[model samples]
Structure formats: structure tokens, C-alpha cells
Target: MPKALVTGAAGFIGFHLCRRLSAEGFEVVGLDAMTDYYDVSLKQARLDLLQGPDFSFVQGRVEEPGLLMRLFSEQRFDLVFHLAAQAGVRHSIEVPRDYLDSNIVGSFELLEAARAYPPRHLLLASTSSAYGANTEMPYRETMRADHQMSFYAATKKATEAMAHSYAHLFALPTTMFRFFTVYGPWGRPDMALFKFTRAILNGDPIDVYNFGDMKRDFTYIDNLVEALWRLAGQPPPPDGKSVCAEDSLSPVAPWRIVNIGNSQPVQLTDFIAAIEAATGRSADRNLIPMQPGDVPATWADTMLLTRLAGPITPIPVDKGVQCFVDWYREYYDC
Candidate 1:
């Protein structure tokens, strides 16, 4: 079995990825800081489940000095999935430094670690926020994402550029995927679906941002996990031609950026309806204006993924929301 290393293995997405990779015959090494970013218990629970014969968990922060370097030196990873990130749009407003520390500095450290010991394929998790201020509906990977709307987006965009430089100069085969608004079982508490579910379940009023007019390309976790697994083996080569046309695939370097999303933008109200339907409870919603550093909508033009993977993996919002609601109820015993 090939060796795989995934950072932020305790995170919702990372946890799912590690579990899938372990199931798919990879000797997985999972790393996480286990920080109280949202809920440490949840992170611990995610990590605890990964403890098995094929999995090894490393407890450490990615930004910590000499930590990743040591791990890289000790283990020759066939693939390195950097999923750990300081993720938040509004929180970045409160503490912009955290974004810089985790997203930029930590990514630099990972590139340095990879520089010393290169993996067969290095995948970085970017965000759709990197497509900041690009009003183009259904964000494509090749769009001009020069104007970042938030510090979090800036740091993530910086990581993409930094990774590209490493790929071009050091010959590191890199794949960067811009994730849409992902939600599902074991999802982040900071996200919309989880919060809405919790508030509705507890019979509390839920804040409907953008006056409930916003649209999100709500991606299910399983679809994202499948995309990552498929992309891990499809890194661009050094001699590949940059797709000059409008597409997400990289042209010059052995690095490409693709969007992983459901490709369907469901309205916030509709999303809540799904939650309400799933939980059998109508939510008391407090309509609010758009929060700062937030886009009115986010849609992913997953044409590249569709062409490559043959019809983008999609889980209907109703079904996906119900799955999450079920998991939330079971996990919290609500």
C-alpha cells in the first residue's frame, strides 16, 4: 500500500479524507493540532475514530517550528494532502493574524518540508473565497481572482501562488482544489448547515444572512472526498501545456487548480427548508443584511471536474441536508 500523509486529519473534511483513504488501501498518517478553533471535542472525536491498524495519528500544529520538517524527514509520503487551514470569513475580521499564521506561514512550512522531501503528489486545499469579488456566476478556476474580499481569502490565494512557484521551480507535482461551501456529517459548527440545524433543533431563532437571499454551492462531504481521491493521482506534469482557454487546469507548471462543488446554487431559504423538512421543525429566522467579507453567492463552475471525472458527483440538497440532520441528531443525541 502507498503511504499518505494528511494534515488537519482531525478537521471535518480531513477526518473524512483519512477515513476514506484508509479504507481505500492507503497506509495513512494523520496530523492535527486539535485546536479549539470551534470545538475540540468534535476534532478529538474525529481523530479517535481514525485510530486503527492502518492509521497513525500525529499530534502537532502545522505552523509549529520543525514539526512538519521532522515528520517529512522520518516518513517518505507518497502523497501529502494539506487540508489544515485557519478557515473562516467573519472570524478573519476579528483576528486576521490567525489566517496569516496558519494559511500563509504554515503553507510555506509545508512547501519547505516538501522541498526537502518531495512527495509523488502534493494537494493543497484552497477555498472558493479565493475567487473573491469575481462576480462571474459559477466561479471557474481560471478566473481572475486578484481582488480578495477578506484576509482569509488573501492567505488562501497566497498559498496557491506559493504552491505554484514551488511546483514550477522545484518540480513538485502539485494539485490545488478550490472547495465550495461544503457541509455534511461531522461538519464544522461555524458553517451554515450545522448552525441552522442546531438552532432549529433547539427551537432557537436562526440568523438568515443576506436576508436569506444568498446562494451557496452547497457541496456534500462525500462528493468532495471522492474528488480529492480522484485528483490525488492526476497531478499535472512539467511538460504539460497550459490550457490557454478558460479552464481550471494549469498550463505552465505541474500544478492545477480545480473547483470541487455541487455546481448547484440553492437559496439560503430553500436550504433552511430542507433542514426544516429533515428535522420536522420550522426555524424561526431572523433576516439580516449581508455580513462583511461575505459574498452574496458562491457557485463553482466544475466543468474541469465534470470533463475529467465524468459528470460531477452531486448529492441533492434535500438528501444531503437530511443526512447531516440525522448525523447531528445522533451525534449530539438531541
Candidate 2:
């Protein structure tokens, strides 16, 4: 079996990917800092489900000096998934240093490690937030994303540049996938779906930002995981040849950026209605202005993703929200 090292293995996406990889017969080493960013217990619960013969867990931060180097030297990972980072746009306003440390510095550490002990394929998690101030209806990989509205987006964008340079010099096959508003079961507490479900079920008010006028592509976890799995096997060659014209493949390096999204942007109000229908309760909306560093919308241009991973059928927001509500009630005993 091939060996894989997944950073931030306890994170929402990392946890899901680790489970899928382990089940597919890969020897997976899962590392997480276990920080109290939101709820460490929730991360721990996710980690619990990943315990098995094919999986091993390490409690450490990716930015810890020499950590990735030692691990890379010993394991010689066939695949490296760098999914761990300080996530959240609003929170980035409160603590910009955390994003710099985890997203920027941590990614730099990973690139250095890969430079020394290169993996067959290296994938990093970026966000649609990296699109930043671009008002483009459907964000494509080839678009200019230099103007990041938030510190979080800036840090993520920095990582993409950092990884590309390494790929150029070291010949490492790198992929930077930008995820649109991801939501589903085992979702983070900081996300809108989880907060809305919890507040609605408990008869509390849900914060409806931008007066409920915001829109998001809202990709489901399962669909995102499937896209990731397909992309894992399809890494760019060092020669920089691409499969499509719209490919974001770097001209000088074996690196590319793909957007994984539903390709169907849903209104915030409609999303809340989905939660209300799923939980059989109505939300007490506390309508508010858009928070800092928040755009009114985010939609992904998934043409490259389809070309790279084949056709994709994304779950509707209603169905996805229903599944999440069901899991939330069962897990939290609401």
C-alpha cells in the first residue's frame, strides 16, 4: 500500500480525506495540532473515528520546526495533503497572526520538507475566499486573485505562490484546490449551516449576514471528497503540459489550481429555509450588515475541475442541509 501524510488530519476536510484514503488501503499518517480554535472536542471526536490499522495519528502543529522534515525523512510519503490551516475570514480579523503562522509559515515549512524529500504528488487546501475582491460570477483558476480582501485569503493565496515556486525549482507535482463554502455532516461549528441548525433547533436567533442577501456555491463534502480523490491520481507533469485550455497549470512548474464547487450559487435566505425545513423549525433571524472582509457572493467556475476529474453531480443545498441536520440532531441529541 502507498503511504500518505495528511496535515491537519483532524480538520473538517482533512478528517474526511483521511478516512477515505485509509479505507482505500493507504497507510495514512494523520497529524493535527489539536488547537482550541473552535472546539477541540469536536476535532477529537472526528479523530476517534479514524483510529484503525491503516491509520496513525500524530498530535503536533505543521509549523513546528523540523517536524515535517523528520516525518518526511522517515515516511517518505507517496502523497502529501496539506489541509491544515487557520480557517475563517472573520476570525482572521481578530487574529491575523494565527493565519500567518499556520497558513503562510506552515506552508513554507511543508514546501521546504518536500524540497528535501519530495512526494509523488502534493496537494494543498486553498479557499474560494482567495478570490478576494474579484466580482467575477464564476471564479476560474486562471483569474487574477492578487487583491485579497481578508487576511485569511491573503495567507491562503501566499501558500499557493509558495507551493508553485517549490514546484518550479524542485520539480514537485503540486495541486492547489480552491474549495467553495463547504458544508455537510461533521461540519465545523464556525460554519453557517452548523450554527443555523443549532440555533434554530434551540429556539435561538441565527445571525443572518448581509440581510440574508449573500450567496455561496456551497459544495457538499461528499462531492468535494470525490473530486479530491480523482485529482489525487491526476497530477501535473514537471513539463507543465495541461489537459485543457483553461487550465491554471503553471507555465514554469508542475503546479495547477482547481476550483471545487457546486457551480450553483444559493442565496443565504434559501439556505436558511433548507435548514428550517430539515429541522422542522423556523429561524429567528438577526439580520445584520455584511461583516468585514466578506463579499456578497462566491461562485466557482468548475470547468477545470470537470476536465481534470471528469463530470461531477453536486448535491442540492436542501438535501445536503437535511443530511447535516439529521447528523446534528443525532450527535448532539437535540
Candidate 3:
């Protein structure tokens, strides 16, 4: 069986990826710090599900001294999925240090460990927020992402550059996947979908930022996980030439940055309607202006991922919303 080490195994995306990797017949090593960013219970619940015979758990911080080095020395990971990060947009404004610690220093530790024990493929999770204020309608993999509104995005973007440099310098096979608005069952509590669901179900007013007029290219978790699993085996080869001006793949590294998103953008109001339909309650919305570090809309250009993953980038928003609502209902018994 192939061995894969998944960081942030207790995170929303990490949990889904871990489950998918285990199902795909990989001997998965799940590592998580189980930070109380939201509720530790939620993290524990996800871990409980992944705790089967094939999956092993390690409770430790990725940025800790010698933690990754010791792990790499113990086992040769065929693939490494670095999904762990301090995730939050507005929170970064108040606690930027956490982003530096987790996304930057943690990734540095992981990379240094990989430099010691090279993996066949290394996949790192990035965010569409890294696009910053790029007003491009459809965010392409090949775009100038120079302006980042949030500290969270800056750190993630920094990690991409760091990973690319390592790949170029050491010939490490690396893929940095930029994800747009991922949501589904077992989603993060801090995300809009989760917060909206909780508010609507509990008869509380859901905060509608930007007067509920924002749009998002919300990628369903399953579709994103499938794309990630397939890409694990499709590592990019060294492309040491500046062949063209259009390509985003690193010219001197075995690395590529692919955008994974639902090509369709849905209005925030429509997303709320999906939640309302699922929970049988119209939301009492508190309409507000767009917050700092918030974008008005995000739509992805998935030309590269579609070519690689066969035209199935995102599930319908209504279906995806219903799946989350159902899971939420069952999981919370409400």
C-alpha cells in the first residue's frame, strides 16, 4: 500500500482528504494539532471517523521543533499533503502572528523535513484569497497575484513561493493547489455556509455581508478531494525553460499551481436560500457591508483542472448545500 502523510487531518478539508485517501487504499498517517480555533469537539469527531485500522493519528503541532524531521525519518511518505494552516480572513487582522507561525514557519519545517527525505509527490493547499483584489472575473492559474488584502492570503502566497523555491532548488515534485470557497459536510464553523446553517437552524439572525450580494465559486468538498487524490499521482516534471508568457507553471521547478473551484458563481442570497430550504427556515438576515479582508466575489477558471480531472470541477450549489444540511442535521441530531 502507498504511504501518505496528511497534515491538518482534523481540519475541514484535511478531514475530507484523509477519509478519501484512506478509501483510495493509501496507508494514511493523520497529524493534527487539534487547535481550538472553533470547537475541539468537531475536530475530535472527525478524527474519530478517520481512526480505523489503516489510519494512524499523531497529536502534535506541525511547526514544533523536530516533529516533522522525526516523522520523515521514521517512514518514507510516497505523498505528502500539507493542508494544515491557520485559516481565517478577518481573524488574521487581529492575530497575524498565528498565520506566520502555522502557514509560514510550519511549512518551512515541513519542507526542511522533505528536503531530508524526499517524497514522490508533495501537494500543498492554497486559497483563492491569494488572488487578493484581482478583479478578474474568472481567476486563472496564470494571473498576476501581487495584491493580497488579508494577512492570511499573504502567508499562503508566501508558502507557495517557498515551496516553489524548494522544488526548483532540490528537484522536489510539488503541486500547490489554489482552492476557491470549499464547503460541504464537516465544514469549518468559521465559513459562511456553516455559520449560515447554524444561524438559520437555531432561529438566529444570519449576518449577510455586502448586503447579501456577494458571489463565490464554492467547490464541493468531494469534488475537491477527488481532484486532489488524482493529482497525487500526476506530479509535474521539471520545466526549466521560460517557454511562454501564458503558463503559470514554474520555469525552473517541478511545480505547478492549479486552481480547483466550481466554475459557477452563486449569489450569497441563493446560498442562503439553499440552507433555508434544507433547514425549513427563512433566515433573519442582518445585511452589512463587506468586511475588511473580504472580496465581493470569487469565480475560478478551472481550465487546467478540468483537463486533468475530466470536466467535473464542482457539484451544483443546491445539491452541495443540501448534502451539508443533511449531514449537519444528522451529526447534530437536530
Best by TM-score: 2
- Relative to the true structure, candidate 2 has a C-alpha RMSD (angstroms) of 0.7
lDDT of each: 0.91, 0.93, 0.91
Model 2 per-residue lDDT tens digits across residues 1-334: 8999999999899999998998888999999999998898999999999999999998898888899999999999999999999999999999999999999889998999999999999999999999989996788899999899999999999899999999999899999999999999999999999888988989999989999999999999999999999999989877778888999999999999999999999999999999999999888999999999999999999999998899989898899999999999899987
| C-alpha root-mean-square deviation, each candidate | 1.2, 0.7, 1.5
Candidate 1 lDDT over 1-334, as tens digits, reads 8999999999999999999999999999999888888999999888889999999999887998888999999998999999999999999999998889899999999999999999999999999999999898978887889999999999999999999999988999998989999999999999999999999989999999988989999999999999898878777778876544655555677888889999999988999999999999999999999999999999998878866556655999999999999999999998
* C-alpha RMSD in Å of predicted model 3 compared with the true structure: 1.5
**Per-residue C-alpha lDDT of model 3 across residues 111-219, encoded as one tens digit per residue:** 9999999999999999999999999789988898999999999999999999999998899999999999999999999999999998888899988999988999989
Question: Alpha-carbon error at 100 in model 3, in Å?
Answer: 0.7
Candidate 1: C-alpha lDDT: 0.91
TM-score, cand. 3: 0.97
Minimum summed lDDT over a 10-residue window in model 2 is located at: 235-244
User: Which model, 1 or 2, shows the larger lDDT?
Assistant: 2
Q: In what order do the candidates fall by TM-score, top score first?
A: 2, 1, 3
TM-score of 2: 0.99
Over 4 Å off, model 2 = none
Clashes of each: 1, 0, 0
